[model samples]
Target: MISGILAYRNIQNSILNGVKIPHSTSQPLIFGENGKYYLAVFVFFFSREDIEKGLVERPTMWAVADIETGKIIEIRQTKNKEFSDASYKIKYNVRADAQYDTSKKYYEKAFAILDSCRNEIINTDRFNPEEYKHYLDMIVANIPKEYQRFYFDLSV
Candidate 1:
């Protein structure tokens, strides 16, 4: 069985390789469906130069990946009109910002797909909380202190 931490790393690497651009990813949220694990994360695209200048652009997108294979199943811009409808319009530039708004839908289409598949939010049977915490700590250590706050919340 794949551990949640391993799945998270695999998916993260897959996304990084696939994007081929400077970006930052939110903490992955893992779920299971049809006996297979999956993960969803928000990605903020920006240039490496922006980091040195302390000006990270905030164009956000979201992706879902198959944990076992680390293949991205779907990825879409959060501001894409194709995914937005009258009932679910894009009002926030960031997924984290949408999380607090009770009036608007956040990742409505992606969540619908998962819901259709009967996806169950999970942390995986083999998840080791202690190890995962250590992993996160290591990751945070490399990030500048001013930017470290973004890694703390995994609600998305």
Candidate 2:
């Protein structure tokens, strides 16, 4: 049961520090799937008025990382229910080769289905802490029951 602060720190640090990416501005929701790690980086890009009024923002990105191998294999981005291109890379720490099937499999599958998972959250006009959790819950719920575990809210 990797939840609360430990799960948050593990996923966030592994992705941000492991992949050499800049630390995320806000918290991210982390969960596991089939021994691989996945995170939803929720972003609010609308105006202050919209935010104050509990409007959901656009451009939420879902990141899939191989934590055991310390690599970010894929990322899917969305803006106003539309898919956007995102960069995905294998960290230098993980050698991308046949010898590492467990890690490579996660990356490969993540890449293959990146498009289908975009814009998973549809409520763009209502954003709140509760809604955020609901969105994460929805994302997690969509995952196959056997491949899911350790949902947590993490802050940078």
Candidate 3:
């Protein structure tokens, strides 16, 4: 039951082909199918206006799959729905993601953020740093060679 906070923009600004949250979920998680350790990541954001447009701003699930070890190291489940009985239903989806998956710069920039933003992450309720970092290493071990740039060591 580990949850993360990814700005509403990160996914929206992604460059991967058809890398939509719900759609691309299986690919990442499937990689863990052959691994030793499994990880599941769930990101949640709240927005009032996004509801009118039918968006998943509340919960974003990202499960990790290690192809060689047959393990699902992580899981992320997204849930975006109305708070029943609540009067306020209009919330803005996370403003936007600052980077795109298709670019190396994106990963580098993200790495910088991860290195400097540990405290911010905890304060933002976007992650449980201790848990996610350990799982991230397990997830990265399965990444293809070319994509390795997207994975980095963020030890603070």
TM-score of each: 0.45, 0.29, 0.25
lDDT of each: 0.49, 0.36, 0.33
Cα lDDT of candidate 1 equals 0.49
- Candidate number achieving the greatest lDDT relative to the actual structure: 1
Error of 2 at 122 (Å): 31
Error of 2 at 11 (Å): 5.2
Task: Give lDDT tens digits, candidate 3, residues 80-149.
Answer: 4221221234432322333324355544444343333333443553444555455444445444432232
Put down candidate 2 lDDT per residue, 79-100, tens digits, no spaces: 4332333222211111122232
- The stretch of ten residues in a row with the least summed lDDT in candidate 2 is 87-96
lDDT of 3 at 84: 22
Off by over 4 Å in 2: 1-7, 10-42, 67-71, 79-156
Work out candidate 1's RMSD over C-alphas.
Answer: 12.1
- Ordered from best to worst TM-score, the candidate numbers read 1, 2, 3
Q: What are the clash counts of all predictions, listed in order? A: 0, 1, 41
